[model samples]
Target: MMNFEMPQFALAAPEIWLGVMVCVVLVADLFDRSGEARFAFWLTQLSLLAGVWLAFYTHWGDSGQTTFNGMVVSDSLAALLKAASAALAALTLAYSRDYLRDRGLLKGEFYLLALIATLGMFVMASASSLLVLYIGLELLSLSLYAMVALDRDNRVGSEAAMKYFILGALASGMLLYGMSMIYGATGSLLIGEIMLAASGGENALLLAFGMTFALVGVAFKFGAAPFHMWVPDVYQGAPTAVTAFLGSAPKIAALALFLRLLAEGLGDLQAQWQVMAIILAVGSLAAGNLFALVQTNFKRMLAYSTVSHIGFLFLGLVAGSEEGYSAALFYAISYGIMAAGAFGMIILLSHKGFEAEQIEDLNGLNDRHSGYALVMLLLMFSMTGIPGTVGFYAKWLVLQALVEAGLVWLAVLAVLFAVIGAFYYLRVLKAVYFERVENPQPLVSSRGPRVVVAANGALILLLGLFPDTLIALCRAAFGL
Candidate 1:
C-alpha cells in the first residue's frame, strides 16, 4: 500500500520563507560578533524586501484561491497593502540602523522580531478566516509587545511594554469573544461564509454585536481615541526608531483588514456601522488635535497626529462611495511616506546618546543644515495639507468624497478640524525658522536616509503637481 501526503510548501511558502530568513539573519549576526552589524542589517532588510516581492510574484493574482483551506488569501488589496507595509518596514530598517546602533539596540533579534511582525501584518491582510485573522493579529502583537521593551535598561521601555501587552491582550480577548459570537451566530468560522450568512438581513443582532467587538479590536490596533490612551505613552517610552515603525506601517495593514473584514464581508451591515464610524472619526479628530496642542515631546505630538489621520481615514469609509474607498487608500499611501520621512529626518538630526525629539530640537536647523531643513519644511507642510504637496491631494480626495457622499456637514467639520490640526504642524515650522537655538548641531545623514528624505519629499511635491497619476493608481488599485 502506498500513502500520499499533500504538498503544503507552496501554500505556506511566504511564511516559511520569512521564518528561514529570520534564522539566517540571526546566524549572520552570531558569526560576526564585532557589533559592526550593518551588513547583517542590510541582509535582513533585503530579505524582507525579497519576501514581500516573492509573495506577490508567487501569488500571480490568486485572489480566489483558499490557500490552507481558506486561511491565507491574496488579492489586489492584500498585495497593495503588503507592498506598502514591506516598503515602510524596509525604510524604517534603514532609518533605524544608525539610531539603534547608537543605543546599543541594533541586533539580529531586533530585525527578526520586526520582520516577523511585518510578516504577521501580511498574514492579517490576507486572512480569510476568523481563526487566521486572530493568529495573524497575535503574531504581530506579540512581536510588538517585546519590541516595545527592547531597550533593556530603560525604565520607560518596561512601562511601555507593560501598557502595550495588557491593553493588547484585552483587545485580543474582546475580538475573540466577538469572533466566537459570530461563529455561534452563523455556525461557521470562515469570513466568506459568515458574510454570506449575514446577508439579506439575517442574524442582524449577532452580526452587529460581533462587528462592534471586532471594531474595538481594530481601533485599538490603530490606536484610535478612547482606545488610544496607550499611543502617546508608548510612543514616548519606546526608542524613536521603534516609534517610527509603529507610527508608519502597521496602520496601513490594520486599515486594510478593517476594509476587508468590516467594509467588504460586512458590507451588508453598512447602515448599522457607519454611524459608529462617524462618531469615532469626529471624536478622534477632536481629542487628537485638542490634546496634541499641549504636547512638548515631538514623538507624542506625532502620535496624536497619527490619531487625527486615522480619523481622516475613517471619513473615507463613512462616505461609503467607491470614490471614498479610493480616497482612503491614497491617504494611507501618502501618510505612510509622510510619516516615514518625518521620522527619518528626526533620526538624521539626533546624536548617538541623545534623542532629538523635541520641537525645540529643530531650532536653528534652517541655519545649520539648510538642505535638511528644506526637506523637513516640505514634509511638515505636506502634513499640514498645504497645496503643491501630495497631502493636499490626499485631503482633497477625502473631502471631495465626503461632499459627494452628502456628508457636507461632516466635511465642513473635517475642514475645521484640519485648520486646528495645522496649528501643531506649523509649530514645527516656527521652531525650524522663527525660533532660535544656541550652538545648533547640523543634521548628520548617511546616503540611504538622505536619499529616502529627498525622494519622499520630491514625491510629495511631484505627485501634488501630477495628481492624476497617483489618483488613477489608487482608483485602479482599490479594485473593490
Candidate 2:
C-alpha cells in the first residue's frame, strides 16, 4: 500500500479561515431576524480580527514558508500586507456604517462583499503561482464590481458599475493573454520555475513581448494614467463607503501582485520591464496631477491623487533593488492608511441627504470643527509630501531609491510634479481653513468613525516622526 499524507493547510491558515468566515457571514445574514446592521458589523469586525491574528501567528519570526505544492506562500511580506488589508477593511466598515445606515443601504451584503474581497487580497498576497494570483485577482475584481453597484437604485452607480465591469474585463483579458505568452516562453506555471527558465534568456523576444502586455494590465489595475479612465467615475458614483474600501485595502494586494509577478518572476528581464514602468509612472504623474487640478468633486480629485501616488510607487519598482522594493511596499501601506482617513473624513461630514463630496462642502470646516480640520490638515499635508508626515517619508524613500539607481532626471521630474500636486492638496486646505462655510448644517459623525479616524491621523504623524520601525519591517520582508 502506498503511504499518503494530507497537505499542510496551516501554511494558509489566514486565507482558509477568512474564506470560512466569509461563508459564515453570508449564511448568518440570511437568518438575521433582528434586521439590525450592528449584528453584521460586529461579526465582520470579529472576522477581520481573526484574519489578522492568523496572519501574525503563522508568519511571526518566520523567514518564509511555501506549501500546498508551492501554490501558496507565507512570508513576512505576505503577512504584513494581509494584516494591513484586514485592518484597513475593519476601519473602512467602521467609517461606512453610519453613512450606509443613513441612506438605508446598510445591509449585510456590504460587509459580506468587503470581507470576501479582503480574503481575495490575502490570497493574492500569498500567491506563488501565476494561476493562483489570477484567481485571487478575479475574486477581488468581481467582488468590487458588485460592490460598485450595491446601491442598485442609483443611476450613477449603475453606470459606474457597467463601465467598471467592461473595463475590468478587458484588463483581465490583457493579463490573461500576457500570462499565456509568458507560460509559452518559460514553459512553467510556477513563478520560481519561470524565474529559472527566463534567467537563461532563452526566448528574449517572447519574454519582452509578454512583459509589455503584462505591464499594461498591471498599470490598469494600479490605476495608472492612460488606462485610468475608470477611477474618477467609479469613485464619484460609488457610495462613499464603498469608495473608501476600494481606495484603501486593495492597493496593498496590488503591490503584492507587482512584486510577485514583475520582481520575483521576471527579475531577469528587468531592463525591458523597467522602461515600460517608467512610461506608466511618468504618464500617471502628469495626467493625475493636471486633471485633478480641474476637478470640483472631492472624490474625483482624490481618485486622480491616487493615480499620482501610484506613479511614486512604480518608481521604487522600476529601480529594481531590494531597497527600492521595500520603499515601494512602505509607500503602498502609507497611502492605504491616508486614503482611509481622507475618505473617512468625507463620510464623517456627510449627513442624511447630503453626500459631502464637493470641495465646497469643506468650506469653513475649520470654523465649525477645528479638531476635525486639524486631522484633515495632517492628511492633506501627508499627501502633499510635506515635512513631518508619513507622506513625506514615503516620497522621500522612493526618491532616494531612484537617486541610488542613478535616475536623477526621473527623480527631478517626480519632484516637480509633486510640487504641482501639492497645489491641489493645499487647495483642499484652503477650503477647510480659509474659505467661509457655504452650508449651515453641522458636521455629524458617530463615535466609532471619529475614534478610528483620529487614530488613523495620529498614526500617520507617528509614522512620520519615527518611521525606522516600519522601514525596518519593510526591509525585513525582502531579507535585506
Candidate 3:
C-alpha cells in the first residue's frame, strides 16, 4: 500500500540513502574507467559510511513505530540489529578492499551490490509484514547470488553461482508457500495480525504446518543443518574477498532478520520454534565441527566452523528470554568480526598468484613473520573459545542462558562439542607455532590492510577485556 514517493522519510531514510548511493556509484563508474579503479572503490566505501550513519540517525529515538502502511518499523530490537548489520558491512568493506583490488575486482558496482544487499537486510530486520520480509529476503538473496560469481572467469565461482541460485529459488518457493498457508489461516499477512489469529486458536493445524515450512525457509537462509549443503561449496569456490563478505556481513543481517521474524513477531510460539532451533543447533554443531575436523582446505574448514558457530548462536535463542536475545546479539556481532579477521588473514597471506588454501600454508609461520603468525594465533584461540578472548565470553553467555532455560543436558552437549571444536582450532595454532612448512616469504601486508588487521585483533582484546560497556549498550538498545 506504500508508494515509492510516500512521505515516510523517517522510516525510509536508510533505504533512501542506500538507493541514492547505488546510483551514485554506478554513474561514477562510467567516469572513472581507469584500470586501477581505486578512486571508485574508495568512493563506494565512503558512500557505505554515509548509509551507516543514516541508519542510526533516522532510527535513533524511535521504538515500535510502524511506518509506510505497516511495511517498515523502528523498534528497539530492529534498531540494534540494523546498526550491527551496518557495522559488519563496514568492516567487511574495509578489510576486503586490498583483496578485492588484487583480484582485479575493484568495481564500484560490487560495492553498490553490497550496499543494496545490506539495505535489504535492514528492511528485513524492521519488517512488520510478511510481504515486506519476503521482498527483503529476495533482495538480499539475489544480490548475493550474483556476487558469488563476481569472478566471471573462475569456473568454481560460476559453479557456486548456479548452486546458490538454484537452491535459493527452492528456499524462496518453500517460504512463499508457507506464507500463503499462514495467510489463508489468518486472513492477513501482517505479522501482528497473524499473531492475533494464532492466539485466537483458529486453524491450529494450519498454523503448525505453516510454521514448519517457515522454519525450513529460515534454516535455508541461515545455512542451518540439512539446508547447509550449499554453504561450504560456496565459500570454497567464491573469490576469497567475496567469501569474506558472505561469511561475515550478510550472515549477521540474516540472523537479525531471523530474530525479528521468529522471536519478536512470533513470540507466543516460543515453545514451538525453540524446539526447532535446538534441533538446528545440535545438527549444525555435529555436522560443521565434525566435518571441519577432516578438511585440509583452510577456507572450507572455516566455512564449516562458521556453521557450528551459527549453531551456538541458536543456543542463546532457545533460552527464549531477553538476556538470551541480548547475549545472542552480542555473540553474533563478535563472531562476525572474528570471521572477517580470519578470512582477511587468508587474503593477506596469499601473495599474488597463490590461493593460500591449505592449513599447511600456515606452518613455520612464526619463523617467517612472528607478528602475522601471532595475529593468526589470536584469531584461532578466539574461534576456539579460549579464555582471555571474546570468543570465550560469547560462548559463556549462550551456555549461561541455556542453563537458565533449564536445559542442562543441552549445555552439557555444548561443552562436549566445544571440546571437539577445540581440537580443530588447535590444529591451526599447531600449524602456525609448532610445525614447519616451506614458507619462503614473510607474511607481509600493505600498510592499510595491516592497520585493518591490527584493529580487528585489538577489538577482540578490547571486548574480551571489558565487555561490560558493550553489553550495557546492547541492553540500552534492546530497552532492557
Candidate 4:
C-alpha cells in the first residue's frame, strides 16, 4: 500500500480555528435562552481576536507553505488579509450590536451567519485552486443572501434577498463554467499548474474564451458596471447593520480572488485581459458616478460609489506589474476600512424605529452632534479621495501604477470620473453641515461604536499622513 503524507496542519491554523469557533458558537447558542444573543456577541468578538493573533503568528513565522495538497496556502498576503478581515468583523459586530438589539434582530443566528461568512472570506483569501476559490465564493454569497432577508417582517428585505439569490446564482454558474473552461484548456484545477500550462501558450482560443467568462464573473462580484444590477437594491433593502458587513470585509476577499485568478494563474494572458479590465474599469466609473448623482438613498448611493471604487481598484490590476498589484491590494484594504466606517455611521445615527437612510436624513447632522458629523465628513472625504485622506493616496497610487504602465489615457478618464463622483460625496457633507435637519433625534449613546467610528475616521487621516508603512507592507506581500 502507498503511504500518505500527513498534511501540515499548522499552516492552516487560522482558518481551522475560525471553523472550530463558528461551530462552537452555534452549539453554545442552543442552550442560551436569556442571553443567547449577547453571549454570542462576545464569543464572536473573542473568536475574531484569537484569529487576529493567529494570523499575525502566521505572518511572522509560519508562511510559504501550500497546505491541503495545494488547495490552500499560507503567505504574507493571506495572513495580512485574514488579520484585517478579522479586525473588521469584530468592529462590525460592535457597530451592529446596538442596531440589531434595537430592532429585535439580536438573535444568535445573525452573529452565527456573519461568522460563517467571515470563514468563507478566509477560505477565499487562502485558496490556491479554482475549486477552493469557488467553494469559498459560494459560502460567502449564500450567507449574504440570507443576511439580506434577516428582517423577515420587512417585505423589501425579502424582495432584495430573492433578487440577490437569483442573480447571485447566475453569477456563480458563470464563474463555475469559466473555471471548467479554464480547466479544460489548461488541464489543471490548481492555479499554479494553470499558470504553468497557460505560459506554454497552448489552447489559445479556449483560454481566451474562458478568460472572458471569468472576467464577467469577477465584474459581477465586484459590482462593476454592466453587471451591477443587484448592488443598489440589496444595499437599500438590507438592514444597515447587514449592509455594513456586506460592504466591507468581503471586498478584500474579492481582491484576493482576482489577484489569484488573473495575476497568478493567468499572468501570461496580460495582453488579452488588460483590454477587458480597461472596458470594465471605464464603464464602472461612468455608470457608477452618473447614477450615484441621482440617488437619494444613502445606502444605494454607497452601492454605486462602491462600483466606481471597484473600477479604480481595477486600474492597478490592468497595469499587470508587481507595483500595480500591490497598489491594488492597498486600495482594497483602504476601501474596506472606509466602507465599514461609512455604513457604521448610518447605524450610529439610526434609532429603534427610525432609519437614517435618506440623504435628507443626514441634514444638519453637525447641528445635532458635531463630533459625529466631523467623523462623517472625514469618511466622505476619504471616499471622495480628497487630499490629506487615505483615499487620496489610494487613488494616487493606482493612477501612478497606470501611468507607469503607459496607460495615460485611461488614467485621465479615471480622474475625470473621480471628479464627477466627488459631487455626491460633497452633497452628503453639505447635508450634514449646511442643510437643515428635518427631524432631529439624538444620536446613539453607545460609547463602543462611537469610539470605534472615531478611531476609524482618525485612521483615514493617519494613514493618509503616513502611507509608507502600509505601502511597504503591500509591496512586501508581492515580494517587491
- Among these predictions, the greatest lDDT belongs to 2
Cα-based lDDT for every prediction: 0.82, 0.90, 0.82, 0.88
Model 2, 193-294: lDDT tens digits are 999999988888888888888888888888988899999999899999999999999988889888898899999999888988999889999999999999
lDDT of 2 at 132: 96
Better model by TM-score: candidate 1 vs candidate 4: 4
- What does candidate 3's lDDT look like per residue over 8-63, in tens digits? 77777777777687787777778875765555567667766776677677776677
Scored against the true structure, residue 373 in model 4 reaches a CA lDDT of: 92
Supply the global lDDT for candidate 4: 0.88
Weakest 10 consecutive residues, lDDT, candidate 2? Answer: 437-446
What TM-score against the true fold does each predicted structure earn? 0.94, 0.97, 0.96, 0.97
Give lDDT: candidate 4, residue 471.
Answer: 91
Query: Each candidate: how many clashes?
Result: 0, 0, 0, 0
- Summarize candidate 4's per-residue lDDT along 229-314 as a digit string, tens digits: 99999989999999888888888878877888888899999999999998988888898999999999999999999999989999
Clashing pairs in 2: none
Model 4 Cα shift for residue 385 (angstroms):
0.9
RMSD of 1: 2.4
- Cα misplacement distance, residue 427 of candidate 2 (Å): 0.7
Model 2 CA lDDT for position 473 = 83
